[model samples]
Target: MKNVLVTGFDPFGGESVNPALEAVKCLAHLKTETYAVEVREMPTVFGKALDCLYAAIEQVKPDLVICVGQAGGRPQMTVERVAINVNDARIPDNEGNQPIDTPVVPGGPVGYWSTLPIKAIVQELNRQGVPAAVSHTAGTFVCNHVFYGLMHYIAESKAAIRGGFIHIPYLPEQAARQPGQPSMALETIVKGLKIAIDVAVELEEDIVTMGGQIS
Candidate 1:
């Protein structure tokens, strides 16, 4: 059975709960005849986020890693297309560390494409009634930080591990605080993630398709 490490961020930005972790926790104990899932909660801090991710990677040694984060205004599950080496945090992270125009890994490559079958994962999620698409930018925040760090680790270690990041919308309770913000049910997000993982494990090559933002 393949071991999969699914990670999610803790509550940040003065929020009490993070839907990403909530969904991930729901799948923590999943073990099938073909796959075994292990879930981890990552800190929302900038530098420390990667620290936790690295520790988790060391412990789990998963064949696949899918990092999940909260995107408050997003309406669907977004599979990131790439992780840039830049880190430009507009707001301070949980530990009040904010860096602008900095490199995620100094002297690292400009960016790294996701090793996961992202397009195929999105297609499967969408086919299951979960809104999903390829997201070009993970923003220059902790989400991007972790994404870039994971890809860097994979490249530097020369390990054949497939990894990518996925962003989920805010929970309904979170949206109640800010009127007009779109939110998705936690159950739906979990279902979408499960489908995403299933597709990622089953597909070796991504389906040819046009995906990403315009302009």
Candidate 2:
């Protein structure tokens, strides 16, 4: 049985339920006879989120890592293609810290391409009738911060961890508050993530082939 580490953030932005964490928890139930899944939650702050995520990676030492976050304005599940080295948050994080034009890692490269098979994931999601796309930007918020940190850690560490980030749309409740926001049901998000995890584990061979072409 292979182990997979799944992570999501706790509620931020004055919301009661975060679709990121909710979807991760829902997908974590796929622990079956052939695979083991572990789900962890990280803080949504700047300096602390990356450290917590790396600690979880070290502790779990899973075969793959998928970090999920909320992108409220997006209309669908977005497979983020790059994590940039910037922290220009539009709103204060959970710790009440908002950074403007800050580097995610001082002296790190400007960006990191996602190690996950994003196009394949998008195809898989679309096959399931879930709207999905390749998102070029994870935003300059904490999501990008954590995503950049994960990629940087993978580049520098001895751990052979494959890492990527996914941005989910606003939950129905969240979208209801903002009249113009696009909303997706929690169940659909869960199903999409399950397919993503299944692909993350079951499609390693395809990942190598497609990843080479992508690079």
Candidate 3:
């Protein structure tokens, strides 16, 4: 059976509850016949996020890793297609570090494509009536920082592991304060995540489809 490590960031940006974290916590005891799932809680800080992720990787030695983060105002579960090496945080991280125009890894590749079957996961989620799509950008915040760092580690170590990032919308309570901002139910988010994990563990290649955006 394959081993999969799923990670979610702690609440950040003045939020009390992060949907990603809550959903991941719910999945901690998930059992499947083909693969075992492990959950890790990562700080929303830039550098420390990667540190926590790396430690979990070393401990879990997972075959696949899916790092999840909360993306306020987003209406769907976006499976990121690529992770840029830049960190241009519009707001400070949980540690109060607001880095602008900084490279996640000095002299590293400009970006890294996700090794996960992103399209397949999106397709499966959509088929299950969950709002999901392939997102081209993970944004230049701690989310991207962790995503880029994870992919870079895999490249540098040449490990046989597939890793990617997913962004989830805010929870219903979170949007209640924002008035018009969209938020998904916690149970729905958890259902989507479970489907995403299933597709990631079972599908080896991504399915080609029309999951793109236009300016």
lDDT (Cα atoms) of all candidates against the true structure: 0.92, 0.87, 0.93
Stretches > 4 Å off in candidate 3: none
lDDT by residue for model 1 over 34-136, one digit each (tens)? Answer: 7999999999988898899989989988999999999999999999999999989888889899899999999999999998899999888888999988999
Q: Poorest 10 consecutive residues of model 2 by lDDT? A: 206-215
Ranking by lDDT: 3, 1, 2
True-structure RMSD, every candidate: 0.9, 3.2, 0.8
Summarize candidate 3's per-residue lDDT along 1-215 as a digit string, tens digits.
88889999999888899898999999996889988889999999989999899999999999999999999989999999999989999999988999999999999999999998999999889889999989999999999999999999999999999999999999999999999999999999999988988888888788888888895
Candidate 3 vs. true structure, TM-score? 0.98
Clashing pairs for predicted structure model 1, backbone only: none
Q: List candidate 1 stretches off by more than 4 Å.
A: none
Better of 2 and 3 by lDDT: 3
Model 2 superposed RMSD (Cα): 3.2
